[model samples]
Target: MSCRIRIRLTSSVVICLALIYIVLFNGLALYSLTKSTYTPASVPVNRGRLYFAYLGFNTWKCKIPHFAKQPLPLTALASFPGSGNTWVRHILQQATGINTGSVYKDYILKVVGFPGEGVDNSSVLVIKTHDWGINERKRYQRAILILRNPKEALLAEFNRKNGGHIGHAKTEHFKQSWKPYVNESARQWFEMAEDWLNFTGDLHILIYERLKADPVNEIKSLLNFLQIRISQKELMCVLENMKGRFKRPSKNLTNYDPYSHEMRSTLLQYEQQINRTIDKRYRYTTRSHT
Candidate 1:
């Protein structure tokens, strides 16, 4: 064969190999994105790879008709479980008339939530999560850290698990007395709080007590932080509608009280530490409606 013919053949082979490599690499990256959970630590270094994988995933996701049509900055409402996440989400949805998303259902479960509803043209998405596995400040546009008094929060959780009462006789799942459960719950709460409190990203700290005391104003502050707008009338309307919706019989059903002197002291210590860390690391203050 002539030299020109040989050169053409070599060029074609090179092009084919390049195409194959691109296909294989992108395929592997997409697979990884699907299977693994995303954390700041685990984020791929290759910007190009992550970009394409996200694009492909979104394209596939858009097939669902109910997905948000506009892409918005993802805003996260993050907290440990039983820390009033659901109530806050309800308020947010009611105030804005926009559906908030959940990463647990969307990312972890790969069900119809958040980004799974697929990419839309929406300007904002609010997601709920109990995960502190990733550095959220770096990932999300904004994050709201909702906290409650650990003792109350843990008691609420215990009661919820025990079928709306705390003093149920020890069962298989909760064989230990209430004290152990509360202690374990508090430990988990502190661990999650520590992980998230260290985040240097845009964050707003909300106290559940403050919200309970004055939901309208507290929700207004939250909406402002999120850059969401709602009129005074609308805000009041939402609050009025949501009133008494979250009241639980557990509050009256449980004669057992765990907020003893020791528990109070322990929680106070953790709160002080958390407060100091917040003061040092974050610009946002704990909401005080007093």
Candidate 2:
């Protein structure tokens, strides 16, 4: 009887150890969910492989899209600063498995998964820029111009310049930089839209508000424009993994009203002009295409 009891005890110990191992292994696997959903654009990463057990009965790893071995058309993703450009790029990267490029080399962005920063070539999917200068505009064979509300875009750009991405500008900036900043930015916003609408290459205008409201459809439309074929699984992964690292918090940082009466009027006029121009341009394009 003592021997029988010893055997039973040994079996129980083995089972308990097995259970403990299962728990720890599963915990580590789940912990990995906190990392970036997709792999970095530039480098091959061991951690880039993401296993989604929760996705379905079957599990799979997300792979980053490879860059074109041969040179492709140089496309530009032009937008005013603070127009959700980075966030859109993140979504594009996640959806297409391709890395998007930018004219500016932001080190922070490079580290946080945008390895294509400063790479402006066919290897990257598209190059991002805020410049509407003639020289900058003339380089791209195609363009995707992202338009955002001036009030929001200006404030977001101000916050980014004064603070950091996801950081809020100081209340004092309202008293000091807000007026001139708004004046210049509002004008730039208007001009940027006008110039891009007249872009001599294939152009697609993506409104920021529409994207926020219906990402799947907007992204699908965008992909169609880029002529990038995306699978349903990949698109699902992108939708599920929405809201990447760069999106700023929705709350306002300060209690002060940054927009003065004159500033508001000027911005409103510019906004109206941009909206009308966009509508007119698209109507003309639609007629031409048909």
Candidate 3:
């Protein structure tokens, strides 16, 4: 072969190697960043075993009324805002083995304004949400909601919003803006809880603290509420593998833009205030759970 041709071939090889190295290096860097940023701001606990219910939902595709190899666009999982809705959704995603991404990412979880980069799109669309009303999911065909103790919900919110006891994301602004809504917000929680408690709607409500306490039965109750029946073996399997957020102490959390230590005395005051103010409706568990 000519010397010139040989030189050209060597140059091409070197260029290809360089490009490959760049791609690999960048990929690793991206992975590290994502891993670091992905720390959780733990979610509130609910009644029953979360794993069982989530698996059952994922198994929804093959259920009697529903039959499709792929999950429906209309199917969703939402929670009321300010609650640890994000963590709840993440655990469900983990247990169900649903690939995250696609349609739900854009509409359901637009929290941080960052790229809602999903890990996978093939999994069931478990939307993490906190907005509750008769028609919150009106845009979607069907949904399931997870409910948390309003006080505890506030506690999580306080931590998540600023990594402090009471996050002043825009504290002064929040106070001024929140004043009118404060009473309104409490009323809304009461109404939403009571209304949905008796709701004969198409939605299913999963109470948070109860789920945390007795996950198995609560999950069964939820399944029954959804009219979703699963076999005992499958139920057992899901329960065995499940670990919801409240299962761990949230006192140490990275709930916000920066992490926080709820173990502080000052922060405890905010938690107490929120606990005191939340509607009493969600304070008690339903007759069955008790």
Candidate 4:
């Protein structure tokens, strides 16, 4: 071949190689963008893939329609503080194969009931709360309300240290805290109990003591109301998982300061009365629902 002709042929080969590299790189990048954790914006509304004929590399441009709505399951787990919802949640986490090892931050963790945190959200969610929330938004279902006799709840409260504000000890010390006197504490609890028992609602009430005493059946009843199906094997696994404590990090401790010993002791003084109040408020039945 003439020198000029040979040079031209070499240049053409280089250009073709460059173009092939560019196309391959772009295709891989597009595939990766689709699978990333952060959702991609420009990848069409539904489905679009550039399919290439392997033998010739001829590509077909295509798009697929996306379904109109995404379905996510939402359920509410509401309980009086120290009513053993921690154990309930543990059972759920184990059965779902959700958290493989480390804890998974649930996308829909919200506090409902007293001070509702998830009052606004588009995602399907599960909420944990003590106070009952009125179903004004039309999003919430009738609740799974767990009740512990206020007296036992009071004892369990100190043991689990699950009190929202009280758990703070307002201090890192778990001691040197401020709280209503024990008598007042008990009175406050009982009063809160009274409030809960009398408050009528479409609620499936599960007694906590009964759950601890007989978990499998109590849980089945609880799950039935929620419409969650569980096989006997899954039920056994869930019960096994509920035995441990789920101690989560508390941001509340960061901001709250400990109170003087006097303050904590004073709160202890009225604990009994508070507890009694809670005991009285601890019940509701289908009859009341009627």
Measured with C-alpha atoms, the lDDT of residue 36 in candidate 1 is: 50
Model 1 Cα lDDT, one tens digit per residue, 63-130: 12133456767777788776887567656656665656665432311321223322222343567777
* Alpha-carbon lDDT, every model: 0.60, 0.74, 0.44, 0.44
Cα deviation of 93, candidate 4, in Å: 2.8
Error of 4 at 233 (Å): 1.5
Ranking, lDDT, top scorer first: 2, 1, 4, 3
| Deviation of model 4 at 100, angstroms | 16
Better of 2 and 3 by lDDT: 2
* lDDT top scorer: 2
User: What tens-digit string does per-residue lDDT give for candidate 2 at 72-146?
Assistant: 689999999999998888888887767889887765465556778778988988898988877888899999999
Among all windows of ten consecutive residues in candidate 2, which has the lowest summed lDDT?
A: 52-61
Candidate 3 or 4, higher lDDT? 4
TM-score per candidate: 0.63, 0.75, 0.46, 0.44
Better structure of 3 and 4 per TM-score = 3
Global CA lDDT of candidate 3, please?
0.44
RMSD of each: 15.3, 9.2, 11.8, 15.8
